[model samples]
Target chain A: MNSNGTTLRRIVLAGFVLLVTTGVRADGDASPIYGVRMPEGYRNWQLIAPAQEAAPLNELRAVLGNDIAMKAYRAGTLPFPDGSVLAKLAWKHVQSPEFEPASIPGAATTVQFMVKDSKKYAATGGWGFARFIDGKPADEAQHQTCLACHQARVKDHDLVFTRYAP
Target chain B: MNSNGTTLRRIVLAGFVLLVTTGVRADGDASPIYGVRMPEGYRNWQLIAPAQEAAPLNELRAVLGNDIAMKAYRAGTLPFPDGSVLAKLAWKHVQSPEFEPASIPGAATTVQFMVKDSKKYAATGGWGFARFIDGKPADEAQHQTCLACHQARVKDHDLVFTRYAP
Candidate 1:
């Protein structure tokens, strides 16, 4: 009985650690949208190296009934010197259930933003116009589609982007 | 001559300060894009606030052209301790040339993700399917006009969204 109890405790501890590490919370606070300023200056910052680990892993996992069709890219906060302003951006992706990455070659949407002094943010740029076709980084004018979609959330902060860090 | 030299020095100093404070550089390397993740002990984190600040901003600025289309908003970051991943989200109200908030709701095109993290992204989602009938966000999903337009950017980021902060 003692041995079993020990095993159960270990499992619980591991799960707690995992949760803490993942930062996977479904509840997010409701903040007014902010505007995105094209990468500006004088703000303290850091860039999260793009994650390639879960990319293919997700694809393979799909076959095992782990086919989570949605994925998101989120940027963290920038503390402006004024201390009153903060900024963030988040992008989400959902694949057509029938489409294959190898065959499709690109995303169907791109969302972005221009967040100003935290109070407001705007969807400044990113491609949000594409269906079956793929988009490339080399394509500039076409990439403007992202801003077109974000045009709806400008009043609050010029931000169509957001922060999940809390 | 002394007066002229002093003026020139002041101008140069102002320019330098602007560059540093704004995070802009003649070489264009200030904007950095970061990824989002969860901290330990969280179940599943998803965006909840600023329901609409998930798109780009610069492009909107160009299209709206000071029309008061939108502004910026509250911003912050989210992080997961284990993976060191962070996600950012913000919100904004996109307006029109009439200087009114976009009457449209939600994104017109689908937000895209790089397939399996292979440096490719596309707008496979239905975010681009809209029509501005009488200057409001109207659903244009029936037109199927978005896909053909997005086909050109297949090589860069796989039609996925990218942040051009430079």
Candidate 2:
């Protein structure tokens, strides 16, 4: 996800997140998926950081890491290993009426991933990307922009925006 | 965790969280562990809610659910099943210079848990509790306070501070 996402980007992400929870698949849209499939059991990963997307998307986000990704984070290794993967789970940010001065997740928005494959995704900083709702991949147009935003902003952090919060 | 914690409580929790990371085991303090050991593979569980502790603790928290716990959450079942388990992972809350108005995880603080087993823990609700650092359990005195705070605050919600945000 873009750290400084444009209004157009947020709008597109908002639409994708909304449609995904409804189980509305774009199966007929035969475009290249960039070979980025949702990782199995991504939900079980440990958190890397917490984020709040500015308005438009207005999502509460948590970035999680696979074991390999976590190891690299703990070791402070630059250029994460090939097996490393990161998952970004997002939800509609809502005020917690039950808890004062706190925000809680409302509806789930998107579950995005960045998979490292030095040999495969070499053209895009060794990371393959995917954005999904209900495990249904977003259109290719969305995938195409992943690296551009990440590279433009946090290319120094191995093309990743999240730091190991813990 | 208390939704409206007192300053004293935050101070105590802060001390415990800070010390745990240093590997300062309280092995000399022989007190009943309440038969609540840290659950295995807890890092792989799905999220329940995100929390931010006030002032003294100044922590970012994410509560996660095991398979049984998640099933009950999604089905809106009251009094979670006997096998259900919840894990609360907390870290020092820090600002992200990389992204504006965003707070990220800093150093890890504590990993706490609530396990539901009505028959075994019928004396003080159906929950068993523990707080740990590097998988080492907190002192028994700390364990004793878990249910008291939770039951006092959120008894209606299965004695849990977290609600399924997604």
Candidate 3:
């Protein structure tokens, strides 16, 4: 099922490339996406780091919304706006980090995303891994490597740790 | 509360720097946080990129599932785990492409997250420029400056993409 999705994605990217290459350019069609007008008060904002001392629980709540994570856990699957294997994979990773059947059934191994923030933008998201199904402790390499995705964020949120300031 | 927390994090970081500079070692008295142990299946867990042909919806789902992006979106604030203001700033840029916040009340700007599949992860989080609030476009400089933080992700997930594989 996952592989099929991958195939589909490849086809779509190919189509987009073709479209961009072969498209007829209207006068207005060439406008840069970056130049699109934004709503009012957008520039008044500056990126401020969330405080580190914020309660982890509050942080978690602000990000995941206590309701969403718990509901997904209870249901055994987390659905997204789009129907894709990536969604299933991310859902499984969050449902159970260990990658056990009981931990996260129907787990896949790929996900992707790009993040945009105020004036600057950053991209991250990555594979979830567990060295053993029932191991006493998850390996450091796996965990740290997972963190490597957000390492650039260290200067921002202290190594990808964000304050769930509500 | 938030300001105080930020101050504490600064102190902790300073102390860590001090310890590292002094070369303070545990001298065999320290224990691993999770009790270090190497596991057998470490090699079995491999990283896989998402399908290149994924549809727009698939890409969107992937972006929405991003742990970092989603957490910030759901919480309606910048959560900084690593205590880096730069990262938080980068996040804001990635979270909202429009440079304005529409979904979040009191928010001054917006951020957008796009998956490797080219799906949009746009959200209106707090903080932004005043011009954006009045509904105008941000300059290219603001959008272009985000590459430094995002560049770090180039090797792992492509410059503009990240993985959320479960």
Q: What is the TM-score of chain B alone in each candidate?
A: 0.21, 0.78, 0.23
Query: Across residues B11-83, which tens digit of lDDT does each residue of candidate 2 receive?
Result: 8898788556422233422224556666546776777777666567877788888889998998999989898
In model 2, state the lDDT of residue A92.
81
Off by over 4 Å in 3: A1-53, A56-58, A62-166, B1-106, B113-136, B160-166
> How do the candidates rank by lDDT, highest first?
2, 3, 1
Per-residue CA lDDT of candidate 2, range A1-166, in tens? 3655677788888878855632224332322445766665676677677766657787778888888999999899989999898989888877666556566778898888888889987888898888887657788788788878888878799998898654
Model 1, B11-125: lDDT tens digits are: 9999888755432243321111212111221212221211222224311110110001011111211110111111222112233332242212222232211112212112332
- What lDDT does candidate 2 reach at residue A38? 65
Best candidate, DockQ-wise?
2
* Top candidate by TM-score: 2
Per-residue alpha-carbon lDDT of candidate 3 for residues B1-166, written as tens digits (9 for 90 to 100) = 9999999999989978865643323221211221111211211112211111112211111112223343433354323221111111111112322212211112323222222211111121111111111223234455444444445434332333333222
Model 2, position B80, has a per-residue lDDT of 93
**Per-residue accuracy of model 1 over A54-122 as CA lDDT, tens digit each:** 232221000000001011223222232112222222223233233222111122222222222222221
Please give each candidate's TM-score: 0.19, 0.66, 0.20
- Candidate 2 Cα errors over 4 Å, as ranges: A1-35, A54-57, A67-78, A133-145, B1-41, B44-46, B53-58, B67-77, B131-149
Clashing pairs in 2: A44-B44, A165-B105
